[model samples]
Target: MRLFLAAIFISLAVGFVNACSPADKAALLAFKAALNEPYLKIFDSWKPSSTKCCSDFYGVSCDPTTGRVADIILRGESEDPIFEKAGRSGYMTGSLSPALCKLDRLSTLIVADWKAISGEIPACIPSSLPKLRILDLAGNQISGKIPADIGSLGRLTVLNLADNRISGCIPASIVNLGSLMHLDLNNNQLTGAIPSDIGKLTMMSRALLSKNQLTGSIPVSFSNIYRLADLDLSMNKLSGLIPGQFGSMRVLSTLNLDSNQFYGNIPSSLLSSSGLNVLNTSRNNLEGELPDVFGPETYFSVLDLSYNKFKGPIPKSLSSVRYIGHLDLSYNHLCGTIPIGEPFEHLGASSFANNDCLCGSPLRTC
Candidate 1:
């Protein structure tokens, strides 16, 4: 089945999840009914081989030892969500129930994208499900401050609440989700400064707080999230120097800080990210030399450093990146002879557009 369970790839000890008790299996059955979408034909759409338990039901994955549902994927074997067929859309809007806390053994709950769900998130989310590891509630019309209580779900690994109408400042308590690995709260109506201690989520691999109303300096502690893989905070009201520690995230792959009020040179550390693939910091007050390695086949594949006050020779060693596809370095004070080489030849002239003195292969003359 193409039903990939990305959240299942965790660092949990193998021995711990190998066994499940019968009682746990029963809890899982009841939890299924408690989960949202009671009217949806998903669980009831087809009669499973066994009626006693929904363990082998569609979108359900059970612990092999205990025969209890460990994961719930609402998609069918055909790789299609039951309700989202080509010519049809669902409109079974209703309130979410607090009874979902019964699924004590569940590690992931991904019901956010369903267009039919509306109403407040279950406040009992944190207190009831101690073992909950992943909670995705994106692309919903969910209203209300995020239940501040979710901070208690220490075992949570991924919390995605993006594209919602959620308001209120991100509570300071959110920093307490110690084991959180991915937090996506983009495109919301959230207000207030990016919390200072937000960097405390050391286990975070991806964080997206863009397209909101947040205002403040990028936190220094942000660099402390060594496990961080993606950080996007664009189109906000942030000001001040981009945090130098941003380069400290050794595992960082994507860094976007565009459309902000940042000043000063981007820390060279960010330029040297070994695992970085995408780097975008356009439309800011940045100054100084851009990394000398943003050329052809460097570590990053897609880079956008346009619309900044950067002044310096373009880095000449960028011909190393063979996988580069998109490069936008226009609208800067850059001055240099673009290397008329294989890697540079493959890139578009827009990459060197609006530069004061950029010349070479991307252009006909200097």
Candidate 2:
């Protein structure tokens, strides 16, 4: 009786093993064969003989009912111990395998933190993975233009391809990404003007495109991104006046447009923004008086408006800010008495250096 029951249990186990899709297993094997895994032996268990494709692989998960691949989270570098150990040498090389698109049910595909994954992203990826909600290939060596039809991935909410070798203009088709919220393509070799209709991404909260070769003026349509909270376009070739519509972002907190070629007066709407905390427009061609809109509730902590062409007295309202940790108004045309406040007193003369005419504690008295 004991021997018969053991045999029945073995039979049930074999039935469960057969439930995993053969196509998904074949795709995983193809992907493994494409990678150069000399240092990272994480795919040792991806044996073709093993029937448990989903359960035995290092970064694969499948739905129990359908036995289809649901997530492929093979992160090379991260704070996680397993990923760090696998990518410790930072040498996982090879082109991305097109076989990855065979997993029909895949919703999340994150292969980030591997700086050695070279070559162009498969052009068919956008059409092949319609169910993908989060596609992050950040901090890799992937080169080539962003897929022109990337907007077809309607389900994607977060698209991060930052810190790569991607070049060419951002496709206007990306405006079709209606559900995208976080779009980061910073630190790349991309050129050309920002798409005029980028404001169509209404769900965007953080749009970081700094440290690139992007040129052209701020698009007037940017006023449509009403939910934008953190906008960083620093260290680029972007020129033109800072858009006054940006001040309308009620939730905006961090705005870094430093090291650009933007000219014209600082927008009054931006100066009066109550939600702003970190504002840096240093090294621009702006010319105007500093705004006197600072209030007790104003969350200005880091105000860097240095190397501009402002001309006027330092605003007395600067004393109203309760928490200013970083302030630099040096190298401007301003002529006035420096405000002697808590944070201002702590600042050095360098903060007010190279101005046309300045006086008070940090400098010689007028």
Candidate 3:
């Protein structure tokens, strides 16, 4: 009797390891049914006869203990052996099926760069997938508002939806993403004011939202993010004074606020920030004498301040900067001799073109 009982226990353990949850298999099949990827034949291995859906299906992973689907990583632009054999990138046309929410244990879902996946993000995702850590569906044609409850994903760290046609105001609750580190929404059709509490995302390192229709003043609260390194809000309709606190950030290296409706003097602290190296404020209503705040720490790869209402002589402090790779002060109302320095030696006439009464080596001598 003892030997028979031990054999039965061993058999049950073997069965547990071999069996795939029927519900998870069904959910995956429904998800596959909605999309069509003809070239790669990626889903061909998803067969009903296979008992191990976890091991059999392409781009699917399952938790070993519970036999539940855990991840679905399928990138259209990849260096996988399959893409190398096919000699082309992936192209799929279909909506993401809501059945994906049935994978309640899913941790990471990345179906990115397909270029033609058109559909609103499954609204049920936030509430249904509590364990999700990385949700990336960028480089697609997906449209519609970001789910309002997106902040409910408490464990999410990377949220990338860039290069899509997604529209609508960034949800206010987005500031609640306590664990978020990388927030990218570039090249979208989004509009409205950035959340005033965006500074609450202390974990964020890069906040990129360029090429949108955003409007509003730069929030002073943004200075609270000490880890923020790169902040890009260019080509938007944002107006109001440039935040002086931006220069006080701990690790901020790149600042782009060009082509907006901002008006006021360029913040002097910005030109003196030890870490900031890239600055562009061209094509706005900014007016005043350029700030005389350049120092030994001033090192810029690109400093574009053209197409504004700046007047008076170019600041002599600019000549003392450590380096200036590309400088553009054109189309302004400035009148005086351009400063002579190593930083300005390589600049051409176009760098100072169209400025009123500006005369020097690059321009006509005063």
Candidate 4:
């Protein structure tokens, strides 16, 4: 009787192994077949004999119960020299495989930082992968407009397409990603104004859109993202008043809007905000008196407002920022005695250079 029970248990285990979906097996094979030689080597473990794709397939994970592919990550190891050879670059090469869409259970697809994958992102991905949560194709050579259909991936949380050659206007439909938290499209050729409805991403915490060709005023609606902590929109053609509503971002840590055409006084509310760490608005057309309201509560470490039209005396309150380390007030129209103290005394003449009639310990006597 014991031998009979053992035989039954073995048979059940074999039956479960045989139950692996045939359709998923064919789909993965088709996806691998689409890639070229050196790239195919990355998947040496993917073999015909390995019927259990969940265990044997390279960079592929499967659902334990369903035996369906759930993740596909084919990124190259940058630290490995064998992966960086000239013509034999160890990274996966070729356009994204349409066969990949056949895996109905796929949730995370990240093929990034390889620099070999070219061509557009599969247009059908959004509809094909309804459960996808992370779609990172950054640091590749993929070009062309981001498909508007991508917004259909309502379950998405992290979308990173940075460091690519992608171009064209950012689709307003992207704002539909209600669950998205990190949106990075920096260092691309993206043009046109940022979508007016960007504030719809109320859950987003960090947005990096710098080093693009975007233009027009920053949408006023962006202030709605109260969870935003790091916002970098530098190296674009954005113009208009810096949104005063940003002061409401109680947790904002780094705000960089340098090298744009933004004009108007720096928002006094922003200067008074408590948790700010780095504020760089240099090389713009900003014109106003530097606010003297910063204090011990305001823990700014780097303040760069150089090469602007600011005019006024150096603030005595500047010394009150106990953690101030990097301060640059040069190339502005300011007239007054420089503030002297621990923070101020540590700064050199260059920090206050090119300003109008600035005199004190760092310069001649006032």
- The most accurate candidate by lDDT is 3
Candidate 3's error at 48, in angstroms?
Answer: 3.0
- Candidate no. 1 TM-score: 0.76
What is candidate 3's TM-score against the reference?
0.93
How many steric overlaps are in each model, in order?
7, 0, 0, 0
- Per-residue lDDT tens digits for candidate 2, residues 146-206, read 9999999999899999998999999988999999999999999989999999999999999
| lDDT ranking, best first | 3, 2, 4, 1
What TM-score, over all chains together, does every model reach? 0.76, 0.91, 0.93, 0.89
Give lDDT tens digits, candidate 1, residues 195-252.
8988799888889999988887888888788888889999888899987676666688
Q: Which runs of model 3 end up more than 4 angstroms from their true locations?
A: 1-19
* Candidate closer to the true structure by TM-score (higher is better), 2 or 3: 3
Off by over 4 Å in 1: 1-40, 43-78, 81-92, 101-106, 291-297, 317-324
Q: Which residue pairs come into collision in candidate 4?
A: none
Residue runs of model 4 more than 4 Å from their true location after superposition:
1-20, 36-40, 78-90, 363-366
lDDT of 4 by residue, 120-207 (tens): 8888788899999999999888898898877888999999999989899999889999999999999999999999889999999999
**Pairs of residues clashing in candidate 3:** none
Model 1 pairs in collision = 59-73, 295-318, 296-318, 297-319, 297-320, 297-321, 298-321
Error of 2 at 239 (Å): 1.0
Each model's RMSD to truth, in Å? 8.3, 3.0, 2.9, 3.2
